[model samples]
Target: MATVRVQQADFDIGAEVAAVTAGRTDIGGTGCFIGTVRETADGRPITAMTLEHYPGMTERAMAAIAEQAEARWSLLGCTLIHRVGRLTPGANIVLVLAAAPHRQAALEATAFLIDWLKTRAPFWKKEHFADGAEAWVAARVEDDAAAARWGGGTAGRDRRTMAPGGSG
Candidate 1:
């Protein structure tokens, strides 16, 4: 099973990783990704960012994403934590961890999870600039392209199943 959480509080990466790997001797590799608030967006200086999402809906969407990752890869465990509400520059925004029997599955699953989250998750973000202006962040074409690379699209589309070895 996968653990998913959407909270306002920041998460400890080390603790989360340990929680996923604990009592798991079969996991030979673990892939992790941590997203943080940057000091700048585009060329503008960003002071802070506020993230918002529909509570129940957001959790359900994230859980589905995790499930998809586990189905597509040989994953033993997964954890996804996304922080909501206002966040300052350098603050942690999201964390994703994928554990599998081999490095390829672990790494690819992690990438797929994050990419899907960026494009499919229902989180909304508003950026506060240094000039005392605020604007809602728009969807990026790059994120959609990243997700598409993993054969991501409409529901019910068949995705290639990957195992420990090179064969899929």
Candidate 2:
């Protein structure tokens, strides 16, 4: 099974992992990723990072991504939680966990889920520098490549890109 959530509060890694694998003995390996806000970028101070997302649409997209990952790999369980709103310098941004029968499947699926989530999900990030200036973060080429490895970007399949009364 796969679970997805978007919340403002921080998450507990150990609890999240335990919850996902509670009764699952089939999984022999588990993979996890925790993304945290960095305080410095090459000695420059970072004040804050604000994340923007569409409430209903973002959740649906994330659920779909989780489903895709579950189907693409031999996954026993998966959990994805991404925090929104204003976050301080060292807050946890997101967490991706995957459980599988083998380490390879667990690790790769975890990476794939996060990489695709970054590009496909409708989440935007803004960075505040120490000088008090803030700027919307530009999408990274590395993020593009990460999503591309799984096949393609979210363009045509994006819910927001769909017609007003139609699914994308």
Candidate 3:
């Protein structure tokens, strides 16, 4: 079973990992990725960031992404948790865990999940600057390039061209 969550509360990484691999003797290695809110953007001081997503739609999209990852890798278990609402610098934003019988599979799955999540998830972000200005975050070319490596880019079947409400 895969673990997926979209909540505003913080998560315990150690506990999550333990839960996923509790009785998994076949799991030889576990790869984890923790995303955090950054303090700056484009050399500008950032105060906070707010993440918004369509409740039901967001979860379903993530599930599809997870399924794709499982199809590509020999994964024993997978976990993806993303925090919503306002977050300050250094706060935990997302956690991705992948378990497999080998380190390579685990590592690759973890990387693929994150890259796809960044590009395919239906999440919108607004960054608050220290100068009392805010702006909606735009998709970056680097992120698209990252997801493209895993065949989940804009051209893929699992691609998320526009966010919820049909906005880009």
Candidate 4:
């Protein structure tokens, strides 16, 4: 099973990793990725970003992502946590962990989870600039390409076209 959380609170990565691997001797490796709010986007200085999502829908989409990774790899455990509401520069926004008996599976599963989450998850973001202006974040073509490389069936679709809880 995997731990999935969508919240407005910050997470402690060390505590999360310890919790997942606690008493698990069979787990040989754990791959982790932490995404943070950056100070700039496309050269514009960002003061903050607000992440919003449909409550029930967001968790369902994330659960499907974890399930897919589990099906594709021999995972011992997995954890995904995404923060919503306003975030400042250097604040952690998301955390992903993939545990397996080998490094390869753990690493690949971590990539797959983040890729799919970026493109498929039901979340919207709006960035606030230092100039007192705000704009909704646009989907990058490169993100879609990264997710498509796995061939999980979400290839070539515009980010806005995704339906709630729908894969790919």
What is the alpha-carbon lDDT for the whole of candidate 3?
A: 0.89
**lDDT of candidate 2 over 4-121, digit per residue (tens):** 9999999999999999888878889999999999987547788998999999998988998888888888689999999999999879999999999999999999999888888878
- Which model is ahead, 1 or 2, in terms of lDDT? 1
TM-score of 2: 0.88
lDDT by residue (27-62, candidate 3, tens digit) is 999999999999999999999999999899889878
Order the candidates by lDDT, highest first: 4, 1, 3, 2
TM-score of each: 0.91, 0.88, 0.91, 0.92
Number of clashes in every candidate structure? 0, 0, 0, 0
Tell me how far the alpha carbon of residue 93 in candidate 2 is from the true structure, in angstroms, after superposition. Answer: 0.4
Predictions in order: lDDT: 0.90, 0.86, 0.89, 0.91
Between candidates 2 and 4, the TM-score winner: 4
Model 4 stretches with alpha carbons more than 4 Å out? 155-168
Q: Pick the candidate with the highest lDDT.
A: 4
Please list all clashing residue pairs in model 3, or write none if there are none: none
Off by over 4 Å in 1: 156-168
Candidate 4 lDDT over 1-168, as tens digits, reads 899999999999999999889998999999999999999989999999999998998898899889889889879999999999999999999999999999999999999999999987888999999999999998787988899899967442235436788653
Candidate 1 collision pairs: none
Q: Which residue runs does candidate 2 get wrong by more than 4 Å?
A: 41-43, 152-168
Q: What lDDT does candidate 3 reach at residue 103?
A: 94
Candidate 4, after superposition: displacement of residue 46 in Å? 0.8
Model 2 / residue 19 / CA error / Å: 0.5
